[model samples]
Target: MLGAALVAKKASELGLQVKPWVKTSLAPGSGVVTKYLLKSGLQKYFDQQGDLDETVASAIAENDIVAAAVLSGNRNFEGRVHPLTRANYLASPPLVVAYALAGTVDIDFDKEPIGTGKDGKSVVQSSVLPDMFKSTYESITKGNPTWNELSVPDSKLYSWDPNSTYIHDPPYFKGMTMDPPGAKRVKDAYCLLNFGDSITTDHISPAGSIHKDSPAANTFLSVGWIRKDFNSYGSRRGNDEVMARGTFANIRIVNKLLNGEVGPKTVHIPTGEKLYVFDAATRYKADGHDTIVLAGAEYGSGSSRDWAAKGPMLLGVKAVIAKSFERIHRSNLVGMGIVPLCFKAGEDADTLGLTGHERYTIDLPSSISEIKPGQDVTVTTDNGKSFTCTVRFDTEVELEYFNHGGILHYVIRNLSKQ
Candidate 1:
């Protein structure tokens, strides 16, 4: 993944000092990326930028700096990138080099120069894509389709172990409805999560190893799945029991509902008790209080993780009110029938004094047919205050899908009619 490690390297080469506060990390999707990074001479630059050296607390003796992670991979969501790093940017190898030199993304590449040339004139050099052997890439994929030609099991009715940890038949569709256009207002939803900018899909759909003490782990533990077989959330995705519990289970998320407490936590307002995020969600569902997420700019700003939306949907989150949203995340939310709302400029939960204790009511059109792009929706807070927001649905297709409570549900209804 295009990550902090690479950007740090670029910064080092240009004599730019990455602010020690900027949390940096290198989380490539695979080791092959590392091989090419070394082959392309980019790894040395990463090493130069931020050494696996001093801690932020240690670097505090020097300067209070913000950590910025640059990665080639696409997963740059909030807590998923790393707990310490607040800003994560996805960039090409060349842009990483430029940002490393510039030490920020707040630059006008067209108007501002990155660095000076040795000759004393403006150095306008852009990095070229490194060359790779076509044959090398071709050889790797040569036998992929040939392998798929292997025979399938004879029986159409596949056998299920029922107790398999890696796979399970999800019960989501067991009692599923195939209705159309059930759009409804988000009424009195609780703010399950409140955070600053750049919340990624990784933070939403955590793929890392399941924690032994997490709600997901507890379910497996209760089910007799030993800690050793408790495989990752990614591995247990087929099981709704695991995935539903695993939702919001990211250990790195610093949910404000927990008063700066780290890892899956929230405050169940009715009970005035703090609990793990999943447990809190269960309580809220039992209490019949719908949930909402309040966030700063770029909510859902990392990888296009679908579970980020699905997890919250399962948790009964009816809406997400954010200053802004990463495009793909906004779409994914709608694809799951979750209302994505944007705060009016200069407004957020903090500015309104919403301490995640306030009840929320969202006003929208009664049906998808009446809604239009960039439509205004009213949000009323508990203090008898109200503000208007723009609906985040950017397309008719998204609106239609959302009305039916998600793309799959919409497809099911349409197909049933056909």
Candidate 2:
């Protein structure tokens, strides 16, 4: 809904007519609470723009394809899916607008486009990503915006406070009662990981259904959280304590060439053997070893839930390496102070032999300072194998976010000082 609303507002500012379609289970007049808390004044923001047209509403009520294409097209609705599965596909005004304008979500200031403007003149397409990002930064820096400005108005829809401590908060160094003594160096010596294909955020940090009888559930249960409260893994994002214990808990993770009975790899500190992914993460944390994740194409491809990045950071994952990234999750990783590095073409995760068990060390300050687009960095694995892989961060803006420990901290510190 918020995505739709924002798109509608942006479209109106651009002098475009928008008729959004939303799908919900509100039963016409049910008062549902949502995690998104839009400022009451923002209602005027929508009202001043315009209202849904009768024709558009009628079309939405009558057509399913039109509604779905519009509402789910924008990445904003992608984040809200798991929590609102049954109600998501229903048509509503706000959602329709969001989907219709998904193409404009982030304009790239550097790219040329394939079309002419409405005026029939030559139209140079400015990149929306950089432009909107700069606008947001300027707004925040000028004290006209807050993290809350980016949040939606539905509270009960999911877990965690996007305005406060979403999963991305941890890597930015929030909620850690005591900073580890060597954290400064860990921050300095950051590694850039380059990954390969089909790497979902679920592989980086699973955030779907979890088995209640699993170790993660057991950990939560031991801490007095009940079965019902265990809920979906996505719901526990706010609590770092829970998330850290549950990284890489995907029930269907396949790590190696080995075929049958393969569970996600874990580190068992007691026996020093890699057991399952979640267990290894838990054990690694207990043993004070800092870890990070790296992957290939479509990194963080599933849901836009911030926990996919947050859970790993809380588990001592200092950074992530990938060949490419999905838009929102990349920002979320940066928001949490976890470095996300993309590989240059042809230098990827499989080529680097990242088994998720390799003791990888990074010489960040020097390496990152010299990083350029399509450049590779040398990595020394735990077994002493040395190879060069591509670095992920391609822009100065991204590097600035990494230096400031994530977007929120950067926003907060700049705004506070201002």
Candidate 3:
């Protein structure tokens, strides 16, 4: 609100207008913020330039022109704002307005004028927000009319709506036993997907707008959801059914199995049929075959998304062999009971001459209980290839998490004991 007010004041003083080509938007995080902006008399400035209360319509560039998104938010990681926005910058709220007025990121704010004055004079760019905390949060629990109209179950356990696509009872704890399922070997595993360096959580589990032809979108459509009603993958994350289907569903994912083509596709080994990543995993699960992922350096790099690890586990991926693993994501994998393995230094899939088509067997030297953290494990391929990888169980607690089949499983078993 302060930044918007400053930009409005500065623009008026300098007699400059926002560029015609710039698409502006103001998405305040909450309704109380809108009230504050309105009370401060700064909402009109935002409304005049951008839609005050609407979805952010990201600029879609044409003719291969690179697009950018400058925002006041903290994160500007790849694929966080929009898939089309390759270049992203995190700036102060005032700087965001300044850049929007400039209409391009390639500028030295120290030297460049944000815009020209009304008399063609060049100008260089350089408030207390209302506080309604007590009154605004008074009705926090008292929801609006639409929320009040819905019926809620009056039970200890949640009554999951089977027909609802937004949320579902996840299958993680279904048929769980009190005793922990000690770590099992990943035997005769097929490579689910092969990827290069810097594979982010966004690629593994996208949080963006779902493509109309994606598996998640198809699942929603099959249940009678219209195209416009299919919200983003982030919005429907509570439903494991949709999230499992949406795993590895990023449109820009580059699977080496696709022969240099960029898409969320993989090859089913036995039939050699090209299918969506989730479809292939489903078939492999039906056939009772374990699956693993092969990736290059810095696997699961961006955004420590829990779904990045959970979605792979739901897809029946038993293990991931990458050149390296992101710190938080590596722990997340162990928490989800997915084994993380790192190749020996200076060795990778390309160097080992192992194509993604080969069947893989990961040999733990002993039972999972006896396996020490960070111990070396051997991996063998059906095509006469063998190599060693360091099991990425960094701590004894993490090893125990894997031993119990997951952190949730361990927690549940311990709770049942008490």
Q: Which candidate is the best by TM-score?
A: 3
Clash count (model 3, backbone only): 0
Pairing residues by index, what is the TM-score of model 2? 0.51
Weakest 10 consecutive residues of candidate 2 by summed lDDT: 26-35
Candidate 2 residue-wise lDDT, 1-418, digit = tens: 3433444445666765432432222111211111121321123224433223447545543552223322333332311332112123434655444434442323332463212223311111221234444555566545545655765657664455554323433444445222121112232221222234665665556454445556667776776877666665566665565566556555434444222333455444236464655565556667676666666677788666666777766666777767778888877786676766665677675676655446676545443355454456666665676665554555676666666655665676667666
Candidate 3 at residue 247, lDDT?
Answer: 91
Per-residue C-alpha lDDT of model 3 across residues 301-382, encoded as one tens digit per residue: 8789989999999999999999999999999999999999999999999999978999999997546768999999899999
Best by lDDT: 3
Of candidates 2 and 1, the better by TM-score: 1
Candidate lDDT (C-alpha), each: 0.71, 0.50, 0.82
lDDT of 1: 0.71
CA shift at 291, candidate 3, in angstroms?
Answer: 1.3
Candidate 1 positional error at 108, Å: 30
- The clash count of every prediction, one per candidate, is 24, 45, 0
lDDT per residue (tens digit) for residues 1-418 in model 1: 2333344444465777644444344455544566566664556656633332346534532453445666666566543344344467887755665665565678887898654423211111111123333434556765667687966788887665687766777544556776664688778887787876766677778576677688888887887778778767777777766787877777567677788876677788778787887898888889888888888888887667888888888888989989999998899899888999898899887887777788889988776688887899888977787888888889888888877878888887888888
Q: Which regions of candidate 1 are displaced past 4 Å? A: 1-161
